[model samples]
Target: MHPIAQPRRRQLLQAAALGVAVLSTGCASVSTAARPRVVVVGGGWGGLGAVRGLLATAAADVTLVEPNEAFMSCPLSAHFIAGHQPATDFQRSYSRVDQLGARRVRERVLEIDRTSKMVVTATQRLPYDFLVLSPGVDYMEDGIQGYAEARAQLPVGFRAFEQMAVRQQVDEFLAKGGDFVISAPKPPYRCPPAPYERAFLIAEQMKQRGTKGKIILIDANPNPMPPAIAQPILKGMKGLYANQIEYLTDTSISAVDMGKRQLVTSSGDVPFAHANLILPMRAPALIRQAGLGERWANIRLPSFQSQVDDRIYVIGDSQGTPLPKSGHVAFGSGQRVAEAITERIAGKSPVVSTGAVDLPLGICWANVTHKEAININVSGTVVAGEPPKLKFTVDAEANARSGAAAVSWGNGMWKAMLG
Candidate 1:
């Protein structure tokens, strides 16, 4: 090793020693003799964040429980949905994580046994001294009438692997364009800018292929959400593909008639040749089954600890916070929770700050076309008793510079998570 790398090597050794020495004093489940067991549920962006951080400490034996054999990114998946790229571009195997000394459990977690400190899978019960839940979000299938029955016809594509089904829809639409309706749900859902980005990219395809028909964009909010990037998003939509897309603000889907290919909305029944209905979202069923929270997990900020259970920490979109639901925030929150758990195991308490503390930054991009995009950056700070205050820095307009940056950012993030 080089001379400059020596200090980092020594520090890691010291941390490992501290972790074992402190836990050996007590905590029978985790001690110097046996590494502290940390169970991380979900192997997406947030869960991977926690797993990587814990493994780095060499203080905890990490077990990652994910039903999927490989990891796929929800971020930048609009490219796949819009038929601009393949799903493999955003997918990665968890083999690197397993090779890093974490046990990979390929099973769906049925329930969390809080009393016994074990996670119940179909065939096994995995115990842990610390539990990190980054299970991601689930759509409210019941929110729209007839949606449950017509799920095969309309795929949300917000989650991993689901994009493949939505890509099929996009491919058919671009090939035979009629009225392709795309709806954007209310805020607090995963990837606020994604719905519009999808619309734009598909509309661009319509222009290129000379596909007849328009894109009916029904937005639940008055305009593109977060308010900060509304102007830029609107500009990209109207200025570029005004004829290709029909914009409707403050419109919501009340019901879906799959037989007629129509949507009953607040305005009235709107018919379509095809539809991409982005439903309202909440934390997965596992979070509620575990009594974590209603709609989303009830977590305390800064540390992201569960309000009811000290041993549990919830991060990512699953945690109810003012922060924007983005991949960057999820990954950062996971890292923070891992560090906090490591400190606790080392007989150290997280610093109780007297003043405000900075939360993770949220970075998101909205592609107006294949070569133009807008960037939305969010930073937040919080005091102990107050809610987090978020500030946004968004691009004034769509540009090639932001578009190139988006691709570069995605590559860099995937490298950090899997490479």
Candidate 2:
């Protein structure tokens, strides 16, 4: 052969050999069975994070089991309750998840068979290699007498779609110009500043619409719990809507008379045309049924693995972590848990340390007015020998910029969840 031809022939031979090796490796890795199945409960923020992460890997078969057909966010939902925004602004459909090849089961999870690693629904049993639960919080109705029977008249609207009921009541109060009573439960509920935020927004509405009603804000605690945001919250309440809103501290509602529209509290029997009784919250019933903690699931930080079941991971507001129950933290934790699960499946043992692991990141928004809000960002890190340290960066006060950013963030998050 010519010199150039001889070189070309050798290069062709080498290319063929490389191709053969690639094919051989591919064949060796091919398996007759499918990838491991992962069953995730709840389609809220935390569950969406896990589902998205697992789908991005394209290594696991994901099954998302949620009772609701669509996902409505609890964050930014105060606007909906205050009638500033529509329900669709905070609600989203799961079409994107379906397009991403996830098996979407629109059914409530009935039970968890840990021994077989199966999640039971009314219609089907989903077997999984791993299970993730983020079913969110449930109201502690027993804490207040007559709450269960009077549930319809006194709407809490703490959860997703329930905001509509509260909004209806607020509208009636606005139209009729009567006493609008909004009560705040004790600490460690869904959002610390939510009840106050609700009050501020509604007060703004009352001022704008020329409603004659006075808003009675009853607080079960002396001041706001989780003292960090107390000053700003109180300032917003006292400085902004002192005329339209009444602040009643250290007052607890003992019972409610729905027929009379009267709340018997430690202070007095207050009658109202409208009432929103924000009830105490706890982990969903599924958590307790699975032998997790009675109120919330006990989870090991950084790892997010359940204390009772090592094979299961629980994140978000449902877990009884010292961290704030914010959606941002829940999403971050879901990603962390996904990484941990992937690492473990790869036959790599997680590095055990006597030190602490980093907790989830939290971002919260408290709307002070229609065009302003207080933004809170909490970042926590665990030290080698110390407990997790949380640092909060809050906007000194509500501003137009932060308020705009809050709306943008809500839009972005809703897109990420259901887009």
- The C-alpha RMSD of each candidate to the native structure, in angstroms, is 6.1, 11.2
Instruction: Indicate which candidate wins on lDDT.
Output: 1
- Summed backbone clashes in each candidate are 0, 0
Q: How many Å off is the CA of 335 in candidate 2?
A: 1.5
TM-score of 2: 0.89
Model 1 TM-score on a 0 to 1 scale: 0.92
lDDT of candidate 1 over 78-116, digit per residue (tens): 887887888899999888898899999999999999999
> Which segments of model 1 are wrong by more than 4 Å?
1-33
lDDT of 2 at 382: 64
> Which number leads on TM-score?
1
Clashing pairs in 1: none
